[model samples]
Structures are given as C-alpha cells and as structure tokens.
Target: MRLSTYEIILPLVGTDEKPIEGYTLLTNGLYGAVDVVPKEDADKLQAGDFAGLPAALRERLMLRGHITRKDEAGELADLKLLSRIFKTIQGRSGVGLVIMPTYDCNFRCPYCFEQHRLKKGQDWLDNTMSDEMIETVFDALKDYRARGYMVNGCSFYGGEPFLAKNLGVVKKIADKCREMDLSMGAITNGYDLETYLDFIEEYKLRSLQVTVDGTAELNDRRRLHKDGLPTYDRILRNVELALQRGVRVNLRVNVGKENLHGMKDLIDDLKARGFIAKEEERAKEEEELRKTDPQAKTKRGQFSYYFKATTDDAHPEKNISEQDTIDEMMKIGFTAEEAVARQSQYNMIWNRMKNLFKKEGYPDFSPAYCGAEMGMLVVDPFGKVFSCWDVVGKDDQATGYIQPGMSRFLWNFNKAKWRTRTVDLIPACQSCPYAFICRGGCASRSSNAYDDYFREFCGEIREIFAFTASRLAGQEWEKRRAAAAAGEASMDACAGELTLSLAGPASRFTEAERAKIMETNSQKEMFDIVKGAAFFPEPE
Candidate 1:
C-alpha cells in the first residue's frame, strides 16, 4: 500500500478557503520506503486528493518552509548560511571532513551502506588514529584553510562515531579547530551516545544525529548486532540518557519495506513517553531561561520539542492527547529516549512544507540536499576528502586531496570540458532541474569510466523519484487538523522535488562519448541518484 503523508501548515487555518502549497512524501511501507513529491496548492488539488486518505490521518500533517540551493556570493537568509558557509569556506558547497575514527561497528544493520566494511574483525582494543596521523589530518587541514574559507565544520562519521577509542584525540582536533574550524557535528548510530554525552554537551555540537530504523521489532530487525541479535534495549537506554543530559538529538530513521507499519508504533511510543512533547512546565521555562543565563542552575524546563530544527517561524500545536501519552510513559520507568526517537516518527511530507513557501514568494529554487561543491568538503580521519561517506572512496569517487605539504590535489576537474567522455561523466544528468542541487549525485554511481553498474544504480533511483512525485500531486486538497504553534518561519526559496530525469543542460552528449570513456568512471551515474535521495532510507 502507498501513503502520501504530508506536513503542511497554512496561516488561514480557521478559514474555509485555506490556501495550501508544499511538497508531499510518498512512503511504501512494504519496502520501508520514502521519496519526495512535487508541490501543489490546496485549491489546485481535486477532490480525488481525499480518495484513499483515512480521516484519522488527515490532521497530523507537518509543514515547513523551503531552503536554498544557490551560491553564497550574495548575502542570503540565515538558513542558506549553512550551505553558503560550506561553499564559501571550501570554495564549494560541502567541504567538511567526515573523519571516521574507525570502521569497526558494534552492531550490524541490514541496510548499512558500509556493510561490506565489516562491523568488527578490526581490533578495537588497539585500532585508532595515532597522534602522528591525527596531526597529519590537521596539517592537511591547514591546506584547506589556505584554500581560503572555513569549510563546513568537522563531521565525525564511523561505524559508530563515539565508539572510536580515540575520543580524546577527536576532542583535541576539535579544540585545535577553534583557531580555524567552522563547527563540529556527528552522525552516530546512537549506541554510545549516552556514554559520550559530555562530548556532545561540551562541544555544543551543532547537530549530533543518531539513527534508529524503526519501532522495537522493526528497528531490531533492520539494525542489530554482529551476531544477528537485537540491540534495541541498549540503544534505547543510551538514547534515554542522552536526552536527559540536555543534548539535542537529530534522530535519524531510514524507513524501508519491513518497517513500514512501524511508523505509528514509533510515533505512539514517543508520545507516550513525553520525549516528544514539551518538557515538564519547568523544563520549558529553563530552556527559555538558559538562553539568557548560561550560569543558571540546572532546572527542568517546561517543554521538550521534537519539531524540525529550522529557521522558519512555524510551530504546530503538538497533539494534546499526544502530550498526555508522554506523561503516562514517564510514570512506568520509560525514559525520554522513547520520546526522542518517537518525535521523528511523524510522517512529514516535505512537499507540503516546500509548497507552502513557494506560495509565500520564495525567491530561488536551488536543490540542496548535501554535498562537497568546493566550499564544502568531507574529510576522513586519514586526511582524504570526499563528498560524504556514501559518495566517496568507490572506484569512481575521488575529487581532490588536502595533503600535509601539498598545494592540494584537484584530482580531476576541468569544468569547460568536464564531459569529454561519457564514462568519466554522466551525459544524462547535466540537464536535470535538480542538477545544481544534487551535483551529479554521489561520485560512486558514475557509469562511464566510474562504475560498470552506474546505469542500473541510477535507474533504481529514478524509479523512486517517479513514485514520490505522483503521491505529492495526488494529495493536493487534504488538510491536517493541527495549527502552527509559534515562532518558526524562514526566508529561503523552495526547490521542488528533485526528479531522477536526465533533462537539465547536463544531458548533452557527444557521438563517440560512450565509446571513449573507461568503465570505471564513477562520478557519472551517482549524481542523479542522490539528488532524489533526500527520501532514501539509510542502511539500517
């Protein structure tokens, strides 16, 4: 079955003629799937919008404004600043380093992209970055700094970011960055988040993300230990601790077929735990007070939030009944972890939110999911640069290097003739409307000289995009019952759904281009696939 769940908020909530615009998300729970949909006005939609939608599900929509996908040369809104700083500092959009302290993982998730990298086998008891090697990365960073710009802050990526034994060295690297580092963040699996809560709080991490695939059964099924055993108990325990510790968690979920039905389960669980609601009245007040008084004593705030951390002045009145469930969950010894994870359960169809902004006079429509354009970079602990782990080190995934004593390696770049050959470049993606935003997708999926399987891989992505678009357009009129809370608005432009079509200026091709290119051309096919990947479920 298909679900076109959307998150929308219109100012004219009380009016019978409320306007609607934004993208929608289409989910295929059968496959634990998700994808982006195009935007449509509330008035533009036909009565068919309500065809298959159940009445109880209509009022839970969550909507948001759009973000930018253009260069940062001119001053833009603060939200675009995230991407602007990335390109400005690194001469590209995504130049932050994603240093994996280690490849060793404690658990095994079925869908993990790095499953081939193995969860264990590497001796964690001694495997770690040495002081000398750590300095090598830092020394190389100087070259990045010389490139002129504070690349996106450092990214700690790994089997589990905190599980790396060199936690102390990672700390030192962060400290050194104080003189030139932009900011620091992480994408951990949430296994050791509690044990390392101090690092999160101490660094005041910009975004410390953790992934939990689904509710207990599905989550355990998708994400588990090396022995194929469930790890729900410990992971949840850690999440509980992290939440109580005051560290904001970017809970990540990669929905797939097996966990499709778990959506409501997770949402219900979080609501019951209060982890998704405002903190106790006291906690909400403390959160407000903390803004002015850093020295204020630790007091629980009145509210805890599970809303999108955005620049938009939009807040939906959380479900009142949902709030009550949280109160109940707390009484039985269930920790805030359930709430934290559950908060992410709301099936937000980004299309509605994006369409909302489009109707609000959005200025630009650059598609920006995440990448390393020039100003942005993803650095590995070993000092190598990549767009992101999902896009680097493949046979076709290498751009440049920030070597210790080197001026820097431009690897292979010549924009004017960037595609003299088809294999080295994707002749199909240049013309994509989402091209600028997706940057030819990931480098590994290139078909020309990059990967022999580029076509097949990208073909799969295109299929996903097509599925999402239909859903968003199909649900044009259905309205949710909730209203925007307070204080969440923004000024960024809305880029509609990034389709997987080969239509932008990037699609031109030479007659013999295919014959001249090598089979290992990696960057070619990967670009288009990732643009539409905003909805891609990560490996469990």
Candidate 2:
C-alpha cells in the first residue's frame, strides 16, 4: 500500500518545546473523507510499515480508500479527481444566485474596485436591471427548478443594493424567491436600509453584508455620499434597526493603514449603542423575533463582525499592506502577536478550512470557491450575465446576455471557461495544501494581478497560515503545562479538546473567566474533557 500524495504531516509540540512523539496527519487528495492519525501510527504508515499499528487505525485508513492496495491500481490522478468535483458541482441543488439591481452606489469608498470600471464612464444608472431582465431571471429560475435544482436564495448585489431607485427590482426578485420558497440576502452599503426595512421584513431577509469601516470621522473619508455628506450616524442607526428587526448583520470592516486605529473606537461605539449588546439585550431581541419572525433564523447571537484587508487599487494613494494594518491595530490595543494572529483566525481561509473539516461527515463539498462556476449567474442592469460580482460591470467579463425569445442565454465562451476551472488546471493549486479552501483564490483578482488564470497570491496565504499555526502552537504549550499538573505526559484526552476548542467557535466569557480558560486551563480543560466524553449519549 502506498500513502496518499495529499497526506501531510504537521509536527505537534508538547510542553518541553520539543516535537511530540507523533505528528498530526491530514489527507486532501482523495476529495472524500478527512483522516487524522496520531503520530506513532502516522510514522509507521509513512515508512510503508504498518505492522505495529492498531487494527482499527489500519482498517479505517483502508476503509476510507486513501491507501491503495498493492494488488489494485493506485489512487486516481488529480485531473480525474477534479473532473469528479466538477460533475458533483453540476449536479447539486440550492445553488447560490446573485443579481445586481443597479451599478449605482451612493457611497464612494476610496478603495472601491468598481471605481476603475466606472472611471471610463461605465453608465451605471442606465445599466440598472430592468423589468425585462427580471422576467429573464424568473425564466432562469424556472429552468433550474425544472432541472431538479432549487436555488439556496437570491442575493441583491450593487453599487448599493438598497438604493431607492432599485426597490422595484429588489421587490420583484424577492417576490419570485418567495414564490419558489427560497431565502434571501443582500450586500448593501446600509445608507438606504431604513427605506427598505419593510421590504426586508416582508421577505424575511436572512443576512446583510454591510460595511462600516470605522467611526464616522474615519469612515466618512472613504464611504461617503456622492454629495460628500457624512453617512456614519445614519448607517449605524439603520444597522441597529436591522438587528432589532431580526436581520442578521455581518458588519464588514475594511481595514487599511489609514483607518486601522479607528477600529477600537468603532468597537467601543458599537457596544455603547447596543449594536453589540449584552447577552440579556440579545435574548430580549430574540424573544421578540420569535413572535414576529418564525422563519427568520438570524438570531441576535449570529450578528457577527469581520475584518477584510483592503485590496490594492490602481489609485496607490489608498493602497495599504495587511502588515501595516496589523501593526496599526497593535498600536491601538491588541498585543503585537494578537494583532497578527487575529487576522488569520478570522480570515476566510481559516473559515473555509473549518468548513472543509466539517465536510468529513457532512460531505457538502463546493467544487468552486463560490456558485459562479456552476449554478450562479450574475444578471446586470442590461441583462448581461457574468460569473461573479467582481466582474459584473465589465463588458469583457460578460459570459452571456438575456436576449428576447431565447430559451437559454446567447452563447459565450467564458461560461464554459469558468465552469471548467478546477484545481487540476492550476499546477500551483494542485499541490498546495490550502488548495481545497482557496480554490485558487479569486479568478478575476488573479487574472487582473498576474495576467494568468493559474497564478494566485500564495505568499499572503502562507503568511496567514503561519500566524494561525504560531498561535495554535502557543496554545499547545499551555495545554502541555496544564497536562503536566494532572500527571499526564500526553494530550490524548483533555489537551486535544482544549487546543481545538479555540477553533470550534467563539465563546463569551468575563475577563476573569477568559483568563482562567487561557492561562490556567482549569476551566477549559475540565469543560473539554466533559464535552468530549459526553458528545454522544451512552448506548441504551
């Protein structure tokens, strides 16, 4: 039997600052099942000598089909595996669909990527999705349903989705989704949310991805009205109302060098305004939501926050490196280590890794990073269809268009082009450990930056992993120290759970309680052991 090419060994360290006897082995190439083997067995398997390993361990490795039989042929090639992923993606239902009501946006953020597209007179207003385009969208949805596929939901994307002018288009799409029994979401700037609150409530919007870079002063410099008026207070008020009305708000903070220091103040202000309310406050809100919105699963607890590193634009004046932003965050309050580590912990890469791990049992794998390749088609104002929102307004990126008297879209080569792109096509991604999570990152970003479909920002990805690993290693050290007190030399029982808990979900605790969980490990160690022990009830 031969080891899978995708299997990787990550060294684990114990209390003595030395490598633990065993390594943590993870498999990726198979496109099915995730196996984690302890170090001793991994060592034996690595040497092609599994004689001393436990029967169950060997049987599992064999059962998972990662290990190839000497009598049978070896594992499938990358190209073959990729083909399977593509076919799998094509067959799936509840695929995500995004529609841009209008290219017009109220806020003019400095780093807006669309600015470049708009600079050459893109004619955003005239390009808004029309009634005819909405009919074409319904036609597409009906076609999908006939093909035995249901859309997960519709997302309203825009220069700003909640614009007063776009309300008709938004309502039309939402009405169609309701008729088809689908959920809905939006990526709005929040400036016009108050105007759309009734529409949001009527459709029971699942979530809103809103940007609030920092406080009013810092944010106004970037996200401003075309009239150059400040929108901070109004946006915040709308955000609070959304949460109170049971809509989960994913507050996106676009971090850069200029606005890095404003983050602490933003957090403080959010807390003070009851935007980031206490548990009791959240509980009260949820209780009210239960009566008014039984269909809404967006509880107060799910109103989360995220930090996105601002992407570089043609305008170098606004460009800032992630490291610079991290350093500035450290200056504000976070420790030098935490400033770097937090970015990784909360990054999309890490989130995708966690989801990939969950897929071991769930098996809900996504062939592409998003729905762009398989099921999703972005319909712009003029009935132009694109693969992603990033390329919605670009004429060259349009895959097809909704023409009169057409059963399907008028043919475009790019449709087939994006659908066929998988890890196998990119030599760099084929061998990279994070390939499954990144899916070669954003294709548009790669093409624009490298002028190659296969090239990606591998360096930034590696740095993020480095920061996460370093922080995890520090946690391992604390686990060892705690295990030492219990006269245990190994982390087999409680230590593994304690170390993994950090990655599982964020838990709320008082400052003193958090100290115990992090420093002493008394509370966390006990909690992990009990939770792990009783994960499943004893057989009756």
Candidate 3:
C-alpha cells in the first residue's frame, strides 16, 4: 500500500484545559475524509512502514483512501475521469441563462468593472432588448429544452437590470418565465427594487443579489448615482420592501481597505433592521420542518448576507487581499470560520469539502470552476452571447450571438474554447493537489492575468485550501473528541449514509467494491480506538 499524494497533515492544537498532545490531524484532499492519529502512526505511514501498523489501522487507512493498493492507477487519474463525468452530467443537467435587458445603469460606482461599457455616447447604453427580443430569448430557451438541455432558470444581469427604464423589459421577461414555469431571479442595485416588488411577488421571483458596499455613509460614497446622488437609503428601503414581498435578498457587502472598517456598522445596521433576526428565525423553522420532511421546500424572502473582497484594478491600493479581509472580519467580531465563510469562492470549496467529510459519498467534482464551462450562457441587450459574465460586453470575448429568427444561439469557436477549458487541459492544474477543488480558477481572470485562457491564474488558492483544510481538520478532531466523551460508537453525529456509483470504464473501483469498503468499518469507528484506547480520555 502507498499513501495518497493529497494527504494533508497538521498538528492538532487542543484546548488549554485538555491538550490533545501527540496527535496529528490528517485529511485526504481528494476523498475529503478527516481523521486524528498518533504522531508515531503518521510517521510510520510516511516512512512506508505499513507492516509496523496494526492490521485494523491499515484497513481503516485504505478505506478512507489515505492508503491505496500499490496496483491502483492513482488518485490523479481517478480525479480526471470523475471530472469528465461530472462535466458531462452538468452539460445535460440544465442551462442557467443570464438575460441583460440593458447595459445602462442608474449608479456610477467608481470601482465598477462594467464602467467601460457604460461610457457616454457608447452604443451599449442605448441598446435595450426590445419586447420582440425578449420573446425570441424565451423561444431560444424552449429550443434548448427541446434539444435535451433542461432550462434551469433565468437570471437578470446588466449594467443594472432593475433600472427604472428597464422595468418594462424586466416585466416582459418575468412574465415569460412565469408562463414557461421557470424560476426568475436578478442581480440588481436595489435602488428601484420597490418599483418591481409587485412583479417580483406576482412572478414569485426566487432571489435577488444586491451589493451594499458598507454602512450608509460608506455605501453612499461608493455606490453613488450617475449624478453623484446618495443611493444608500433608497436602496436599503427597497431591499426591505423586497423582503416584505417574499423575495429572497442576498445582500453582498463589497469589502476593501476603504470601507472594511465599516462592516461592523453595516452588520449592526442590518441587525437593527431585524434582517439578521428574520434570517435566523427562518433558518430555525426550516431546520424543524426538514426534520419531519427531508425534501420540504422552505419559503422565500429570508434575508442573508455575505462579504466579498472588492476588485478595483484602477484603485489597486484601495483593494484588500482576501486574507487581509478575513483578518479584519475577525477583528470585527467574526470567528476564523465565520470570517472565512464571508469569501464566497473559498466558502464554496470549504463547504464542499466539509460536506464530503460528513457524508459517505464522492465529492461533487467538476473540471471547471463555474457554469461558464458548464451550460451557462449570458445574452446581452444587443444579442451578444457570452460564456463568462465578466466578458459580457466585449465583442471579441462573445461566444456567440442570438437574433429574432434564430431558433438557437449561433455559437462559435469561442464557445467550444470555453467549454473545453478544464483542469485536465491546464498543465499546471494537472499535477496540483487542489486541482479538483480550484478547477484551473476563473477563465476570465486567467485570460486577464496570463493573456491566455489555458494558463493557471492560481490566486490565493493554495492558501485558501490550507486554511480550509486546517479548519475542517480541527472541526473533525473536535467531533471525534465529543463522540468519545459521549460514549458514542460513531464519530458521525448524524446518521451514516453513503452513496456510491461508477463513473466510467477508467474508474478504479466498481460500485460493489465501494459498497464493500464502506461496510468494512464505519468511518467514525475506524478511529474510535486509536492505539488500543478511545481517541479522547474519559472525564474525571
């Protein structure tokens, strides 16, 4: 047997009262299993002294993928095969279409990435999708559905989708979605959300993602109107109105050095408005309902918020690194875990790994970072279709075009280029330990950084993964310790259930083999007796 290449080992720093000394936390990046073992056992495994370990320990290690059969092909090969299967499944699952009604905006945020497209006298500003175009878009969706691509939903995107002038187009699109039995959502500035609340409620809008840079003072200075008027109060009021009308609001706080200090005040303001309390209550109610009905759907309109690091190439000095933002978040009364959760991208990877450790199933592996490489297609006002939202307005970056008579989008080589950009194709990502998790990073960012779509634009991914693994390991160690204390037979506090499936011909193990391994020993029970005793000592 040989140790997996993706093993991450760290020293366990227990509490002052009960120091978990001489133990190491180990995790496999690919398998997403976490365990605590004695330092000597880890050393023995590293030294390739498998015979020196107990038979039960060896069996457990193999089961968790910490150690694999020497004849096995390897984890990297398995990951590549799994990723391809995942991509194939994603392509058929559904297509998430982004509709840009108009490129015109009511706000002129200094750090807006779409500023170039919103310039004065630009044709993009005057280009709004006509009612005919809206009808054509829905027709294209129906065509895609007929072609075997499920129509997942439609999301409104633009310089600002909720601009007062674009209300007619927005309503038309929402009405079509309602007619098609499709869910509708939007990414808007929220200043004009109140005007659309009636439509939002009527169409059963699933969600709205709105950005609020900071508290009123900080936000007003940042997300200002085109004429330099304050937008904070009006936006907040409209957000509250949307919530009252049963529209889920995802409040995004753009954090930078300039407004990082105001996050606490912003969160405090949200709490004062009862937004946080409402979300907490909704969460509790949903948890209770799910206890009775595992598949029960929860009501919409719960207000939740996350912090995102601002990106401003024009004002590089004002932007804060993600780590710095997390640290600042910690200073503002967030735990390390909570602060990490604020970064959506990192949090997504962290959550996937966390879920993998808790459940008995393979990670939802993907070769691409997001839907750009999957089935996501963004259509702008002028019939330009893009694979990535960041390149929506750039003609050269457009993947295709759509017109009134076209039954389907007229895709070009650019679409294939985007669809084929996966971790396997990226040379750097192939051998990288976090290849499956990072998936070659964002395609647009990669192109912007290396001037090539296929190159690696690994931005803080290693650091993020390290932090995530450490946090996950620490949490798992604590769970096992608690389980031992409570005299539980398993470390998994929840019911143990695992799902196994075959990927393709190249897959290492069959479904039956996977099931057999799972039945050998419960993951928790494998570590239940480490070196002839429970992992944790009994209380006095």
* Ranked candidates (lDDT, high to low): 3, 2, 1
* Residue 225 in model 1: lDDT: 69
TM accuracy, model 3: 0.85
User: After superposition, which runs of candidate 2 have C-alpha atoms over 4 Å from their true positions?
Assistant: 1-3, 12-79, 82-86, 89-94, 120-124, 278-280, 283-302, 315-367, 404-407, 454-459, 465-540
What tens-digit string does per-residue lDDT give for candidate 2 at 1-540? Answer: 766554444554343435545455344433434444576777788788865778877765765544545221223243233334334433344556777887888877778878755664546454666677677777877776787677667888977878977787789878878888888899999998998888887788989988888998988987878889988899888887887677878888888767766778887888788765653566666677779777544344346665667775565566566666666666777764455434633354444444443333222234355566566777776778887777777788788887645555664998887766665456666655555545566776677678864465453655555444434443444565577778776544432222121111112233454333334424335355334434212445
309 Cα displacement, candidate 3 (Å): 1.0
lDDT (CA) for every model shown?
0.43, 0.63, 0.74
Best-performing candidate as measured by lDDT = 3
Model 1 score (lDDT): 0.43
Question: How are the candidates ranked when ordered by TM-score, highest leading?
Answer: 3, 2, 1
**Pairwise lDDT winner, candidates 1 and 2:** 2
Candidate that beats the other on TM-score, 1 or 3, i.e. the better one: 3
lDDT digits (tens) for residues 17-54 of candidate 1: 22233544432211112223333433222233633333
Estimate TM-scores for all models: 0.54, 0.74, 0.85
> Which window of 10 residues has the lowest lDDT sum in candidate 3?
494-503
TM-score of 2: 0.74
